[model samples]
Target: MKRILVPTDFSAHAENALKVAAQVAKKNNSEIILLHMLELPHQMNDAITSGASIPETMLFMKKANETLDEISNRNYLDGIEITEIVKMDKPIHGITQVSKEYEIDLIVMGSHGASGIEELLIGSNTEKVVRNSEIPVLVIKKENPDFSASEIVFASDLSEEAYLPFEKLLKFAKLFDSKLHLVTICTPNSFKPTHEIEKITKSFISKFDFSNLETHIYNDTNIENGIINFSNSINADVISMCTHGRTGFAHFFNGSISEGLVNHAIKPVLTFKV
Candidate 1:
């Protein structure tokens, strides 16, 4: 966790994310890279790519840099090394490209918590970044979030494929020095007897030999609701889950339940691809 990448549209939500990034950076002695993507007009997109010296591009870059400078100067940002990045690309593409190019350890981003059809339009950028990013992504949905997560609820299916993400989750939990509450959401669509669920949960726990952890099987109408309810019941500070990184028609048809939680969960969500 040497570096954190934070993409901003300068909205209240993005400011919340930057605040969270600052907290994490201070704790880890990390650098915060604030990125602003300049989504050029359709006609200027291709033309400006070839050193066209377009005034619009120049103006956009100048304004973005100025905004970043202003944000970096905030009193809250003191003591942390904040770098501003302005790129000419789509938000998702720019974020992914910069994350890889800079070798960022974690990507902290904010979503407006859009849902239903609105989410498909507005919230898709953050969701797309989550699906595409190989590194772990932490999503903040509120305007002012508690960056320090003392209690983290990690919800998983406990499958063999889940171990990798769970490993990543452990590293994250260590960062916060938080107790982990491992849980499985038993929904109506995939109901399981309590004895059977416990057997499987115990088997998975044995593989990791994880100590100072508690496990539970939560029942509800669906995975999203179950995770939310369980997390709230325990007064969790962070909600974590694994995503399969499904894309194309598979993602379209099945839709990602983890993503659904991302859209609605008020607590910070830590997600990684399985």
Candidate 2:
């Protein structure tokens, strides 16, 4: 982890994720890029008289900078390399642009009250980034003053697309020296026998050299709940999965299990794009 990009709305939850990112930075000696965006209404530029929007824009920009400075100066982030960026573009675009500009290794974001909010990922800025970013995104839900990837519950369908992200997951797990709780969720709609699952799992992991690994077959009605239930059963620190970054009609029909998990699961979710 060389640099972490954290997009903030200055909400309590954003701070929650920021604190966790601090712990991560401390662990890896990584730099923290705190990004705040001020998107002036597009209509203002066209409808308002010339220079009419300048005052409000500058005022908001100044206030955002002050706030960013305050956060960077917080004692919790002490001794950490911090960079503050305030962009004028939309939230998702700003995040994408900044991540590339800074060569960020990871993005840590605070979940915006995922409880009972079934509204699809397409509508939310955070979810939009989750759906598009090529790098790993860590969604933090609550305060974890001492966050650690001591154990990660990684659920997979063991499909071919999973291999790529699993490799990224392995690199991360090894970096943190975390135990891997690899699970295959078997639902009624897509059930498979334990012997077959074991056989596939054996073959799937044959290409890797991770020693701190555990494999299991879990049963539940859905993938999201099964992963959550299994994670709860072991009290794992993180829930890991792969997202296909589905969008438009495909996302509408198939819906992303990883995105759904981010919405409902209280535990931190680590997602990588397949």
Best by lDDT: 2
Instruction: Write the residue-wise lDDT of candidate 2 on 208-273 in tens digits.
Output: 888898998999988778988999999999988776665511121145454566667888888788
Off by over 4 Å in 2: 47-50, 116-123, 248-255, 258-260
On a 0 to 100 scale, what is the lDDT of residue 159 in model 2? Answer: 65
Model 1 C-alpha lDDT per residue in residues 1-274, reported as the tens digit of each score: 8999998888877888889988899889999999988787776877777767588788888989999999999987899998899987778888889998989999988766644313421256777777767888888777653577789888876878778888888887788788899888787687879898799889888888458689988998888789899999999988877766665111211455645565577787887876
How far residue 274's Cα lies from its native spot in candidate 1, in Å, is: 1.0
How well does candidate 1 score on lDDT at residue 251?
A: 22
lDDT of each: 0.79, 0.82
Worst 10 residues of 1 by lDDT: 247-256
Worst lDDT window (10 residues) for model 2? 248-257
Note the residue pairs that clash in candidate 2: none
The segments of candidate 1 whose C-alpha lies over 4 angstroms from its true place after superposition are 46-53, 114-123, 247-255, 258-260
